[model samples]
Target: MPDAASNDYSMLRDAVVFLLAAIVVVPLFRHFRVNSIVGYIVAGIVIGPHGLALIRDVEGTHRLAEFGIVFMLFTIGLELSFERLKTMARYVFGLGLAQVVVTGAVLASGALIFGAGWGQAAVIGGALALSSTAFVLQLLSERGELSSHFGRVVLSVLLLQDLAVVPGLAVVTALGSEPEALAWALIVAGLKAIAALGLLLAVGRLVLRPLYRMIAETRSPELFAAATLLVVLATAWGTAAAGLSMALGAFLAGLMLAGTEYRHQIEADIRPARGLLLGLFFMSIGMLLDLATIIPQLPAIIAAVALLISSKALIAAALGWCFRLPLPVAVNAGLHLAQGGEFAFVLFSLAMGAAVLPMEMGQFLLAVVAISMTLTPLLALAGRKVQARLEQRAAGGLEALMTETEGYSDHVVIAGFGRVGRTVAQMLDARDVQWIAIDLDAKNIAQARSRGLQVFFGDAAQDAITAAAGLDRARAAVITLDNPAAAASALRNIKKKLPDIPVIVRARDASNMGELMRGGATSVMPETIESSLLLGGAVLRSLGQAESEIDEVIEFFRRDAVEGGQRAADDEQ
Candidate 1:
């Protein structure tokens, strides 16, 4: 047995090797416009036992790298809200479910044709069907495209796959010696896992917000980080207890926290952890590639990688097109998700452990997954360029609104074309006001345009849409969105980019008044307060009150409104 001192030295040596490789190779790769992921993987292969033999403990390194994925999921959850997730449910459940089922079935059929047993083929199919949530999401986050249409769909599909992978793991574990008995066991376990998830979400909804709020009040970064870590571990444990994966639990915990107020701070605290860990995770995967085992099978490995990337990409693209995404967006999303993912490592290990897959087959599949992942960033970059070209070609009709706004000055930019927006536009039009309006609701724009309003179909909060509305020369902006979240986002976007332009916003209640003002609204009109004041003024006039008395009452209410707004704003500060 090795002494403690010797073991410590070994660990230190391993760390130095890993860190030195990353430091040297990553910058070089980045200088060539290659993704840091490729660099990390390349570094791993070089310093790994298969190459220079500078580092040992590959399995232990892989285990440590998993925390990177956990922290990454946690941060991803912080960026998403339950409301936002709900909006993507169709894509998550529909497209995601279809992708797995169809891809798995087809791949399994192919595997069987290649002389594998049905059970083993099933395991391979399930494993290869999953795309890398970590790799794709990290890329999207780096590119700042997570909020784009293609990114949202890819995220939804990945989330569903994370959940879907649970059963695949179970299936792999069960398919070994007693296929029938364990298959039934997996079914029961899957049901229990679903129940556990439901229970977690229910309980999290009840207490997560309040719990984080309490943590926030303490105002201690250490305490808050501790709490976040606790939540992540507890959630992971809960799912593990139900025979589900810890990563799934971490993701759910993130989803719960996404609905809370402390999300941004939580994200900030965990970002560094996610980055380092993710780098380690990628490097560990690269280390798994044994050139000795792979070189003789080079032709076969290349064939498998090409087949996997092409089949998966085609499936993803076809699904996106079926979902009615724009041609470029569909193609881009498909290309982004073409590669095999991290989950393949888990599935392969489990299959090998259970003696379902022969060692040689498992190694080959592992190489395929690793190589595909290494190639993904380059493919995504090419896809992005192709998408840009397609978008440019398709830009003719899409540019109509921007063209209409060109060379115009002193025009009001109306952000919503709803009831209130229509009223405001009508009033402005009566005075010959030149204005351009953008709304996400196409039907609303169509209706308004039929009635001769200058309305267009586009999200006002989108930078492209706003710029097209002539923000540089706009006289002012009027926001009349009924959705408080959307209104707040639009308010911030406009204020941040066009601070010199004055803005008037319509608010549903006083609850949001302070936030709206803080977000840089020049004026916030509460619908209830304005309507009540209008009614009260009309009633006093009908009561035959003196004109001077009516004027005084109106003036008093207006002054009170201003004071109330000011107080709300101050309290927010």
Candidate 2:
């Protein structure tokens, strides 16, 4: 009984320490525009056993933190549907397959040259050949580049790497088995994995939508959230039970729900939990680093880290270029994915436990991987700078060529394609007005493209996406993003990029209209005011008033609303 109480107390203390570390470290890192992931890792190191010893239960912490990855994968799945995946099939299978194979072979050869046996070399190569999906995705999302052409290629590669984990683990298991039984072990693992995948797909397609619909009909937010959690955990457990990664299961569950109407709500509900747990996951990784052991071999570790990053980066870039990606985009993707991934730790740990790899070598490799991960944000920043330079130097290069092929000129660029934006687009279409739309919702983009609308999937706040949309050649721009903060940000970005271009923005209410105008919107239409005016017009018409009189009354109210918003802006100024 006493031991149980002590364990509970220890867990509570550790949680407090973790939160404190994040509270202090994350904001500091964000203030400098650094990736919050780096901050989380640094926080982990500070409070970990190697640092202040604020948390001694490393394994327990790791178990809890792993859900972060599961949740992250689920959210990523929500962003993609089967149709989009089918479209990306070539990159996923071709570029992704080539990347893993070539990168693994090169690393394995190097390992062999360094005196490691075939089994150990294979493990090392397979593990290091993959890149950290969590780190790369978070970075891309932060920079608003996840929907860019470069980001799409990178995401395709990451998806393949996630799938490759099953085979990688199978190889590790086979290596641990007796010589005569190795082939059998691999075959069994493969069959089990396929069966698990098939079961997940079958169950998800049939069960998830109905489950969500039933829960949503209750109009209970709590029940809906609980249902979301259940689906994520159940699917994750299913895959892990079959000797597959839990994250993969969660991703599959999300993919199933991607086509459903509840996707956006589920994503919103899971976001907070995902961020918190994912940060904890990074902290757990930091706890794994033993500075005392690493200091003695600092120089060698640094050398290995450099080699691992450089080799992976160059190999990825070469393959991407060969696969017909532009030099800049390919190089950027390579640098973003150059670091050793989280799976490396899993593979190395398994190998060490199975007595297939020496503890000393595994520890050394883990340290190298950790250091490389810590350097990823910096590496990605370097890639962006390099890409900018290359793009500048090649003015009429691939980017310009692609833009020319799209043939955008004197068109209205719509920053959002929600209901309001769609209505505006339709009205423009009726008059044959040339226009293009950009949105972050992959599902929405897929549906729009199917109907032959010139809508693209990307963040309008990103200069690269805006440039690709031919913002320079656009006669006007419209900002109708549903989120107020997102709408304001889009307005500011457009005004900054092209101050001379007329920009129309939609506001949620009159209170938001002044803020949008202050952000340099040429005109702001508050939805609430417009709806109220229309309703008032209807009421007057029902009272048998003349149609002309009702129109005049509504116009008077509209002018008053605009004047009121302008007055508010003037008062604030």
Candidate 3:
């Protein structure tokens, strides 16, 4: 009854409160320079239960939140590529593993200190160990840091947290009533994961790519989309049905698709779904915060939240320094990743289901995750400022290195100039970076110099071209390349000879998450799309947005792509 009857009129009810939050707090947060997510959560709390009791039926709201998570995972899957994962193996395995072990250890200790037994304490710790991937990544993408060094490390660790949600959930579930069963269930889960992975690896190498290519050759986008969905959904279902979590299934599907030739296409298709659902996911968090219950505990809870964030940064910084990254880089990376994410929600849910944690405790933890996630944008921005300052201070010593690569006499080193670069040179009047662009086409190079922009035109992937580009001491290498592989390879080569030189590379895709961590990619911006989308959404939402229609439109587009039919009806135009 709570799930069905309550949901029936939920939409009508939600419309008003959601709007109230948007109309009031959204502008307030913007006006005060607070992160918008923080405003949204605060709004949810104000109109949520225990406040105005605007969302009287909590069950219905939770149901919609579930869809938010699903969409969130789907989008996370879209942003990943196999090669990209392999490139940041350090962050994936090392950073991720360390995060799980350390964060869990710390939380488990806290629970024990709070008077819980080992089993109970461990479950509590497990819940606390998780963070909000949806909030963290959304904020990161918004800041255009997905391809930055900080973003890569943070994402690697977060991805680990997401994957860890499976067993952690199982542990919480097992510990609730039958604590003794926890150990056995984990062993079973581990074995199942291995077998599933093996089966996927074999099938992936033999079947997936060719099948997708065959599907693509038919020029049937719907079939391609259907096949893509089938791969992920079926695998996710199989993993969950096999005594694992749905998160594992999704991650495995992404891993399996990593090596495929059609990886980009699959990523592109899934991206829009990821974007929209992601916002809803955050909104769902806003719905969950029972501010009244939390108000009295605000002081202690705020301290805990601050501790949770600060400690993680220290942990990350220590790890980065140990890895021999620049002190500035290490610190920035640490600060950028200081918060907890959505995976924490799963742990709490599992624990509640297992009865290891009381419902109130889980609710409290949700409040914590929501608060932390909402604060992420502001935190990241501040940390970025600190990082920029640190970089500037360090750059004073690196100036000679920069000058060496930028071009001593006359040269052109072009990173992605596009429209912006074209105009930059016209104002220069024969001034050049003493390096040419590493473009795929000669027409681009011709256009650059036709406007009298210093230009060299060739793929940076070639050793001959890098050599020709005067890469040895080209003053500064303006790596304006778009593709990840090309950009990364170019950076590696630049670092080979001019190891200390400053090089800037353009990062234009969210999927190119690892580009910022490459050897010589001093700056990174994975995509400008998210900001544009955010602006668009704000405009739409402000002009009396209708959730039902938005949902219908999104579902239509997704289903069209999913079913491989009616490929954009207006496409005939």
Candidate 4:
């Protein structure tokens, strides 16, 4: 009984330490415009056994930290449906396969030249061939580039790498088997994986939507959240039971729910948990770095890190180029995927346990991978800078502008191609007005382009994107970005560039209308106010109020609301 109490107290203390480290470190990194992921890692290094020794249970911490990857993959799956996956088949299968194969072969050859045996070289090459999915995805999301062309390309490669983990593990296991049994072991592993995936997909498709619908019908937020957690954990457990990675199962679970109506709610419910756990995962990665061991071999480790990053980056870029991606985009994708991935740790651990990798060599490789991951944000920043330079130098020499806005004078410029912007475009289309739209969603842009619409992919709040969209030649501009901050930014940018241009902005609620108007919007349409007015008018009509009277009442209310908002804006100014 005493031991049990002590155990509970120890766990509580560790949790507090973890939270304190994150609270202290994350904000400092954010202050300098650095990615918060770097901060989490730094925090782990500081509080970990190697540093202050506040948290000495590295293995136990790692077990909890892995849920972060599971949740991250689940959220990523929620964003992508099977249809979207099908569309990305070329990159996922072709370029992704080529990347893993070519990169693995080159690195393996290098490993062999360095006096490593075939089994060890194969393990080293395969492990380092993959890039950090969590780091890359989180960083891309932070920079708002996950929907960019290169971002999609990066995602495609990462997806394939995730899928490759099963096979990589199978190979690791095979190495420890007798030569005659090795082939059989791999075949069995592959079959088990396929069966697990098939079962999960079949069950998820038939059950997840109904389960969510039933939960949602209860109208209990807590119940709905509990159901989401259940689905994620159950799916992860099922896959792990079948000798597959838990993260893959979580992703599959998310993919199953992606096409359902409850996807957004599920995403919202899971986001906080995902962020917290994912940060812990990064911290765990940091905890793996032993400062004492690294300091003794710093120069050699640095060389290995450089070699690994450069080789992977060059291979990824060359493959992207061969797959018809632009040089700049290909290079950017390469840099984004240059680092050794989380799976490398898993594979190395397996190899070390199976006696395929020497302990000394494994520790060195682990240190190299961990350090490379820490440098990812810096590398990504460098990649963006390089891409910008390349694009600027060859701006006119590339393919025709994504949107043909050169001859579109006196056209309407829709800043966001979402539901509200789409409706506005449809109204303009009825009048035969030539208009173009700018949006950040790659999927939305693709669908619009397929229908022969002049919708281009870009951030509406950016000066360059707006200029390219011919905002100066626009007769009017509409800011319909769903995010309040984004809408305000677009309004301000448009007013700054073409001060006299009439800009209409969409606000999520009346609370945002005044700020948007003050930011130079000629008109602000608040969805909440409009929705309430419509509902009120309906109620009045149901009570037998005259149509003309109801209309007048609504008009009066709308006018009063706008005037009230303007006065509020004036008072604030």
- In order of appearance, the predictions have TM-scores of 0.72, 0.79, 0.65, 0.81
lDDT of 1 by residue, 212-256 (tens): 888889888999998888988888789878877677788889988
Among all candidates shown, the one with the greatest lDDT: 4
Residue 11, candidate 1: Cα error in Å is: 2.1
lDDT of each: 0.84, 0.87, 0.64, 0.88
Kindly give the number of clashing pairs for every candidate.
Answer: 0, 0, 30, 0
Candidate 4 to truth, TM: 0.81
Q: Who is ahead in TM-score, 2 or 4?
A: 4
- Alpha carbon lDDT at 532, candidate 2: 96
RMSD of each: 7.7, 6.7, 15.1, 5.3
Off by over 4 Å in 3: 1-36, 39-43, 50-80, 204-207, 258-265, 358-362, 397-573
Model 2 per-residue lDDT at 330? 80
Residue 176's lDDT within candidate 4 is 82
What ranges in model 1 sit over 4 Å off?
397-573
- Please give, for residues 185-241, the per-residue lDDT of candidate 4 as tens digits: 778878999999999999998899889888889999999999999999999999988
Error of 4 at 265 (Å): 1.6
Per-residue lDDT value at 36 in model 2:
88
lDDT of 3 by residue, 1-573 (tens): 888876667777776666666678878888988777777667766676656777666666655555445544544554666677687788778867876788778878877887777876786666666666666766776655566556677778777776676687667667765757878878877787678767766776677778887898999888998887787667666766766555556666666666567777888877665554444455567767766767888987798788777877777777777776666667776766677666676666766776777877677676676677777776777766665456534432123224334544345466445554554345444552343454433335446557654454444655655665566655566665655666677778777767777776655644353434435455544445434455656676778889666556555643443233222222332
Weakest ten-residue segment in model 2 by summed lDDT? 392-401
Query: Candidate 1: which pairs clash?
Result: none
Query: Using TM-score as the measure, what is the rank order of every candidate, best first?
Result: 4, 2, 1, 3
